[model samples]
Target: MADYLNNNAGMDWDDAIENDGQEFIILPEGDYNFTVTDFERGRFPGSAKMSPCNKATLTLQVKTEDGIASIRTDLILNRVVEFRISAFFRCIGQKKHGERLVMDWNKVVGSRGRAHFKPRTYTDRDGNERQANDVDRFYDYDEKNFPAEDDWMEITGDADDLPFN
Candidate 1:
């Protein structure tokens, strides 16, 4: 089993678990802080399924970037818990006739030169790190499906969690 802890001012809790049917921790719309620990578990089955926990710290901050739009979160991870991170975003609008939504890192800045990033890290029951490069390729959206400004952008990928701390 895995144990999660949230240590923030006024946060009177100590441990949590995402497995066994508990996946997410709900937080109200405001400025808050949290810490996740003892995530050292084996990966589970299924592509979209949750993996085992590794010793790490995940901090989420919800705030507006420029006062125009609300940037839901700023995730900061400490320690390389897993090889990948995945999430879904709400698609708000439709794409143009031939435009497509592609993961172009060049379009955005300050992403460590990672263009079209994808999740490609996995660990087995033996706790061995496995490299999964080809498995991280994007397949859903094509170049001809350009999304509108209001459309939601789903970003999924892997990163060197060691550098975060």
Candidate 2:
């Protein structure tokens, strides 16, 4: 591993080239915990699936049995795919059921969530087959959305329960 860069001083390209690069990980189909490592906003040209629109590219660090897998996913920001945008916010606790929330991309990084990942096979433009990971669903694991049982009060209102309350 190379030493941390302080101010780009003493940087050597040949020396850095010796360091090994990250390995590609394709996990089996299952749910996994993932953190938003990076976020980028970009425009998407019109495709046959949908019209041109803005998109959010997310770099997720997914925890897998082998190790942490880096998966890059693009989220198209359109009403046609609004469910996916809502799911991401709900999973990260930014949005709750029956509530409205502003899309805050600033806080997206470092947010944690659970999602289902599946292996997908596709052909490259060069005519080569490749295997990659795809997100099946983003789950809502926000604790604040669901009140705990202990926080609930049974409305019997017994005299003895009054003291405990």
Q: Which whole-number lDDT from 0 to 100 does residue 68 have in model 2?
A: 69
Identify the candidate with maximal lDDT: 2
Model 2 clash pairs? none
- Give candidate 2 regions above 4 Å deviation: 1-16, 143-165
59: Cα error in model 1, Å? 11
- Give me the overall lDDT of model 1: 0.26
Instruction: Report how far off residue 62 is in candidate 2 (Å).
Output: 1.4
Question: Of the candidates shown, which would achieve the greatest TM-score relative to the real structure?
Answer: 2
TM per candidate: 0.17, 0.75
> How many steric clashes does model 1 contain?
11
Which lDDT values do the candidates have, in the order given?
A: 0.26, 0.80
